[model samples]
Target chain A: MTSLGGDRSIGRLLASLALAVGGMGAGAVWAPSASAKPPAPAAFCQTYPDSKSCTTGFAECATCHTTAPARNAFGAQLSERLAPGTPRPLSDQAFVSALPSALKMIEGLDADEDGFSNLAEIRAGTRLASAESFPKVMACAPDQASKSGDGRWNVCGYDPNYAFRKISLDFCGRSPNRAEAEAFRKIKGEAAQKAALGEALDRCLVSKYWLGSNGVVWNLANAKIRPAFVIKSGANPGPVPLGDYDDDYNLFTWAHSGDRDVRDVLKAQYFVRRVSDDPVKLEIIPEEEVKKRGRATAQPVPADKRAGLVTTRWFAASNTMFTAIPRTTAAQAYRAYLGWDIAKMQGLLPVSDEPHDYDRKGVGAPECAVCHTTLDPLTYPFTRYNGIGGGYTYDDDRLKAYIRGDGPNVVNAPKSGIILGKPVKDLVEWADVAANSDPFAMNVVRDYWKVIVGREPEVQDEEEFSRLWRGLKDPARYNYRVERMLHDLVLTTAYGRP
Target chain B: MTRTAFIPALALVAAMFAAGCSSLPSAGSEPAQVASIDPKVKFKDGDRYLGDLARALNMPRETVCKELGRYDCFSDAFRIVLGGVEAPNLTVHTPLEEAALTAPIALDRAALHVCTSRVRMDREDPANAVLYRASASGRPDKAWMETTSNELYGVLLNRDPTKAERARLVGFYKDVATEQGKPNPDAASDWVTLSCFALASSLESIFY
Candidate 1:
């Protein structure tokens, strides 16, 4: 598996260098001002020949014209820097002459070489700059706006008139008002574009195999939530990156393959056996004999890594490597076994726990709430989606109804799902928890802001919650609120904390 | 000549234009006559006094031409009727007054039945009325257009309160068509109603 794609670490280095160098010129050039003079307001009005009804108002003109030029400039720069061989620059006068043409040009520039254009990257704000980058882009679009076509871009399921898609999708129709849309676009570019595409790809991969639909949907709530069922059932499951998809199955498949060169089964054994405190009472199974009896039963880890296979039945089990090793003192044994100090191993425990299906037996282990309680409750209001990437599985009837406008009402509707012992509901309720009961969402925000701004926010930053709420409430303030939050967090004393 | 002579003339022209003539205007006429008419209860074969009035008033061919969202009000017709109406002084005169100036001979009350289309057609022409074209274009000088469109809107209101378009056009003319800086109630209703219709249409286009 390691030899499948040899280390291309050099590619990552070059890309990271390009981003750092490009930052100096790119950031300064495309920055749009809320107060800037709008371009071509009167020109748009002139389309109506007989009546100047659409013309003669500066405010009205300002609505559409504010960002056209800026968007054009952004496109121009992107074209020149990313794909010089392309005939047109994004911000060229020719590009501006017809918005559709400009979008077409941007769509053609596959900066990531993942069969998707940078325009898709910009829209989803993912790093699909290369084949490796494809995973991030795939993880982002999933069910909504999934790309399909032999050689061209054609998205299904996403509304063409969706505000975000309006500028990036069609480009031919009337453009979004600059005041409202530009800021959001800039914010997206800044956050997603900063990372090397490969790194972004890697993160996307990690998210897919581990986080699954619940995680992806949570991430997508910041952009838009199309349907709760989309995530819940693992329906279309939009554009998750190929690398993440690949990584997720590769690790699992390797463990079960019975190949000695591969160390995956050993890895699982290390995770399970090392976490036990009382090894003497635990059961341990060897992989060699288990593979020999593979057809009849689940396999077990090799005896070398297993601590007490003969004395106790408590052990780990995998579909290939080991399924489970149940012992009377399994819980106690699990706590005592650790290669590293218990305190240092706590962080690793979050990902290391074997997924338990509470449904399989009458008694079920604690689930998402164990780690996500604080995060889930706090961040609930910020978004209202779960079971993101592969969680949504829709039947034929639901699909037909959705297209016909007779589908389930996913937006602002009550939801019921068991994450732990309790059934969590809507975004508002989620927000309530985040604001009051949960601190993880805020911590995530804090961490994200710190990374963005190069510093942490102070206790006084609590007041920013209201400010952020107010700004987000006014759709016009999207770009500003995000930037201000970044600026405040970075420039403050609190953000600098480790 | 007796008033009956005009009946044949009205019928002949209605037939020529393929307009409904029988049910609309009464064949017998007295030059200064005024009769209350129901807007609803479609006069399937009613007289299309519009063409007669258009011809009588010499309304421009362009004004009578149809376009998407173009022929909304009397002022819109005024533009086509009056050649090169100024934008600044659009509200200076009413649709009737502007029509009076453009086609003085058509002002006789006997021609009122035929005048509706003429006025509407004139409003459609950019040349005839000042405020009209601007108003339709969503321009700043829409006030005058609002005023005239409103007045014509008034005519529609009075003729048939329950007419199919009465409520819709009335709502838009009142709420949306009028100019921003200044508001005129008389024409405001119609102007706003039309403007609202335009807005609603735009929203529908984007969403649906």
Candidate 2:
């Protein structure tokens, strides 16, 4: 968020000054001002790097602003308590430096009035801003867990019997038979039972039902690829038949299945081809040979410039669709891959001097400036890629054609852009930084967590959820293999209990 | 005719369909007119229910149930209501978060349809029957009802039905006999079909 502090505009500095001396408008409820300085998230994460919200390298916007600029309960308290007498609208440098002390002042306060102190909630990885969310270490105390009435289900902790049935259906696409469940229950010990469950999961992980076309992995890509049959060109062709999104789904399923590194979905330079459906095998179409598929849906981005799904022909065709400045393309990538939605004012990290009214979109006004500042810089790298009717290739001249319609100023939009505050020259570098970051791993693991658990992780499940996502980032633990992560996932108390 | 003989829950579900079917265009007559939006069910678990039920019953998935014995149950007539997708054509990428208003009607419509179909097939080939083992004449006995309840639970839920569960199924069979006012041969087929329908639409069956 320090990038937002770099704004050199005199009008904004005056507004920050006016908001500061006016008591932040924090003392009284106020309408959310758009694009409050983006540097606050960075400073918040820096102070509490171990915080659960910062596990992905950025604190949630909910931590401070409700819709940002509009402070939530804790944020309101933080605003009043921050650097008590310092001029309101602390400069980026001043705000970053004073935040730790402001946080300390309110540690004892129950901001949400949930009966838990702010410090306790933060340390426990629960949301301090919401009364409905708090730590639950005692929710399933060891002595109260695992013991049962039916011997068929455990009420409070991981129950092998429950998980066996759940895993069979989730991965294998059908429930286990009575004989199989009976055999699983009869295993002599917990370790042996888990081993048997793991073996069963190992077998299911590769089943045609999990990895095949229209299977689990394939369906996960539906939102990411947003496949539409009208423009679909491959096996099940649509009437218009534009660039096929089967290519996008193929790369997604390939990168996520088996021992493959999950990061390849965003960082790989090669294409994955589905060679068979009956057995569900996907082989890499080496970058050198990517041209053989030479159909209308073929990869048009040269190998060295490719960055997995972000650079796909279908991704460009669907999202960019001939915009001179491709904010929609960047926003879709950020949301689809990083789990951050920009439309809802999420993941806003305003870059300084951005939204320079690029393509003359009239986004420099305060209300429009709030989001476009972060969005426009993000869109810059995408300007080199042609969309939809532009032959689906990357070139520096792609923006020149739009200049005729967007005005002569459109040609001046730069290629360099900032991602999460780190500057990158092009999409490949942007993707590389994004793929290797903590948030990338968190988002990847969350996909499986939601599908398997049938819900998003709750406050009570935070500890196990935190451990599992962190494990995905550790080299020796899961090593980025989604299959290995699923083995642990099936064993979690959250998954197995009830 | 079989719809009128099931448990009260299934019967209530059946009554809704009784009204719904009367409004539908008859087969081989003309295409029905569109009334509103149709969002498709595109996810795996969303479409899994009917297919898994067919597998458990050991019938060809498509033949398990059909609307008017023509359109397949899962894919055609009930596709939109049952969470099937109508994508690209309508841009519905996500499946329904909760079951539709007609979900219960569709559940019994498919379950009772399949159960009745299975009993008919078993009657035609008693020795090779999957459910019912072999056709019996007259009302189903307590032991046979208990066995059928366990079989349904075993195939659908992967565990044996509890004693209370088995007792409920047997009691439902006696209720079916009483509903007829006197001993009747069709009550036996009706009992078997209702027993299967109750388990097929149970909370456990629909969820897991």
Give the top-scoring candidate (DockQ): 2
Give per-residue lDDT, candidate 2, residue A361: 80
> TM-score (0 to 1) for chain A, all models?
0.19, 0.82
True contacts kept of 1: 0.00
Best by lDDT: 2
Steric collisions counted per model: 104, 9
Please state the error at residue A432 of candidate 1 in Å: 10
Residues A141-168 of candidate 2 have per-residue lDDT tens digits of: 3433433432334555566887887888
Candidate 2 lDDT at A448 equals: 81
Over the stretch A295-346, how does candidate 1's per-residue lDDT look in tens digits? 2122232333232211111111110011111111222221221111112111
DockQ of each: 0.00, 0.17
